[model samples]
Target chain A: MIDEHLLDDLALQNGLLEVDAKLKLAVGIGAILIGVFSPSPVAPLVIAASMAVCTIVFAGIPARVYAALLAIPVTFVSMSIIVILFMTGGGEPLWDVHVLGYTFTLTTDSANLAVLLLSRTLGGMCSLFFIALTTPMVDIFSVMNRLRLPDEFVDLSMLIYRNIFVLIGESIAIHNAQVMRNGYSTFRRSIDAFAMLAGMLFVRAWEKGEEMLVAMDARCYDGKFQMIEEERRISATGIATATGYLCACAGLAVLFRSFRIF
Target chain B: MHIMEGFLPSPWWQIWFIVAIPFLVLGLYQLKKLFAEKRETIPLLAVAGAFVFVLSSLKLPSVNGSCSHPTGTGLSAILFGPFITSILALIVLLYQAIFLAHGGLTTLGANVFSMGISGPIVAYALYVAGKKASLNTFVNVFIAATVADLFTYVVTAGQLALAFPAPAAQGGLLGSFSAFLVIFALTQVPLAIIEGVIIALVFKYIIDVRPDILVKLNVLTQNTVNRIREAAS
Candidate 1:
């Protein structure tokens, strides 16, 4: 169960783990914005490539893992891109098709829009991965606190963060037990077993919650949860490098604004 | 099944955020009030939110060998309320975006609005309708959870259609809506049914194991629990 997804483990072991979380967040968000705003696909495609390279090459994330993560959206996105390509109209018609008595036409504008959409999504997802791979949720908690989010919200977020693992661990144990019992030997049985698992999961989590409340109260549970103070000072070089990257992307976007494949 | 990060363009993303903020504020406010009255709810809420995360992670065993995860919003909305479920969904979506990059931060508003806000409301409404109609507990939970699961994707499809209204696509918005709907909503129908079944089974287990918790949470009254137990025994 855990093998399917365990991103925090990656963040903990990343090469850029020690870099400032805020800096990483800024770069990720900046690149995402630049990618989104660019009318052309060129800038977003560049951002996507650069961000993927940074995550895999700079941050030491395994190439296989990166590709696997990226593969998650390929099916849905390709479908979406195709839909946009065939459904949108205007500009020059590049191709025409007659299917089921409907005349479907692909046009220049649609092709350009499809490519742009595909690249923007690619860039956005990669930039998000860059942040996810580089920054641990603990650091993000501190960042959230710094951003003036309510203490209660931050505290609850921390609690939720901690419990996700606990619950996942619990789930894995249950899933294993179910597997051992021949719970999933057939498709129909598997559905029943999985339903039982999902049902019992919340019940188990509720019990865990009560146990945790007792644990916290025993430890003098206060309304406040402490934030990890930011240790890495924001360096001039980090800022300059991030700024340079954002500027380059913005400039590329402007330069290629009118460039189109169709 | 989230609209992966960076899918929605600028103005649409910002518009969703704006639409979602007031609801979030109301949710956060409701949570504060709930916490003030019952201190235990704080942990309960956290765990419930985590429950959503865990639920989403649990893959359904599909016949075709494709993966589909349950939305858990229907169950949560029934146990808690829509207000709290919305924020829980927001938290869960945020975690997915930041850690797993399953959804985009830019599109979190849209995702939350669909999965968190709209799905739960539909579930809650169906639940109330079921309760009023004196429907069987299993059937009630089944329909509510199922339709809610399906409804979330409809909202998502609508959002996409509104955002990307192709001018030349025959019937324009209506035509493109159906096209997008085929991709976003049609595929989800089977998964949604599976989710409903799983959630209905979950409710059965909850009723058998912790009927008091259900009563306390206001999902079912003590009287209804007694009647159900009487009928069961």
Candidate 2:
């Protein structure tokens, strides 16, 4: 089992991580918004392609890593598209079939809708992938802090983020031990083992929480978490380039919508 | 059973965000009260949030040689209330969106409403009813978890169907909803059952090993714990 934590570490090591987090955040949000609100598939499809290029080329993230990241969402999105495609009703029937006394039909309208949905979803996903590939959660938190989100909420997120790695490590050790003992040999045994593991994890997490509280108190800890924000030079040129690219994407979306070139 | 990113249209996703914001506010208010009452609960809540994250991601072998992930929210909803569970769900969903890319930020509101608000509300309701009915702890937990899991998917189906209704079915929304419900049910039913059993067993173990924690959390009274012990013996 590959350590899931390694995924974030890989993002941190990406070349684009050094880029201003605000820029990446803006690009990501801009792409998603354009993808979602666009009237035609042409713009979203273009955005998807461009975002993928940015993530793979500009970000210097490996193509394989990007592909692996997309595989799950692609599978799920495809399933959903199929549901949209096979939904009975609307427009001329492209294909009709009977199965188990129920008639299934593929209509032109449904097909069009599915195409639009697929493009939009892919475009949005690519934008998100770019952000996940480039920015670490800590930086995102820093941005949130800068945006003046409540201190408690930010602190809670930091605590949860730190402990998630710890709990994952503990879970991996317990799962390995269970596997060595043939804990998952049968369905019944797997359930038993899983339940036992979850119970033990809860107890361990609870104990860890108590210990954390004691440790914090020992340092005269207040109810606040002090975060050290790194000073990054926000270059005007970088911001200008990012804005230009986003404006171009928006311009293309507008042109495509007005032209209706599907 | 997350509604993937870009799944809901602009108005629909925004509507869900608007609908879900109140519950999130209420949850924050509850957390504030809890923190004021017991500062130690802050770390405990963080740990609980982490536990939900780790537990939900675990894949367990299911009946018929299939595999599925557990929601892990019903158990927490029972331990903490639905309001707090909603906050936990928000954190878990955010983490999954950023780190795992399992869910998307745009659809976060919809996902949180379905899995966090609707499921936990139903689970907590069922748990309270079961306890009042004097049902066995294991059976109650099983019912709560399974129903809660099933309800989450049902709500997701509804959200999708509402966004994209089928023209063929006379009642557009109803028809599309049934179509999605049938599609999700094929996988969700068995998964829900498996999750239910897993949570039940875990609840039993907790009752056995650390009833004290439950008592402290006000989930169980001292008299109830003694009765549980007697019944086990």
Best by TM-score: 1
Specify the CAPRI tier of model 2.
Answer: medium
Clashing pairs in 1: B5-B104
Candidate 1 ranges with C-alpha deviation above 4 Å = A1-3
Judged by lDDT against the true structure, how good is candidate 1?
A: 0.87
lDDT of 2 by residue, A73-184 (tens): 7646765676788873577788987889888888777777787788888888888888888899899999999999767678788889889989988989999999999998
Q: What is the TM-score of chain B alone in each candidate?
A: 0.95, 0.96
Q: What is the C-alpha local distance difference test score of each model?
A: 0.87, 0.85
Best by lDDT: 1
Best by DockQ: 1
lDDT of 2 by residue, B1-233 (tens): 87777778879999999999999999988987887788888888999999998988887665654335788899999999999999899999888888877778899999999999999999999999998998887899899999999999999989998888877453578888887888777778998998999999988888888889989987777888899899889
Residue B115, model 2: lDDT of: 93
**How high a TM-score does candidate 2 get?**
0.96
Give the TM-score of chain A, superposed on the true chain A, for all candidates in the order listed: 0.96, 0.93
Q: What are the TM-scores, per candidate, against the unseen true structure?
A: 0.97, 0.96
Q: Could you tell me the lDDT of residue A181 within candidate 2?
A: 100
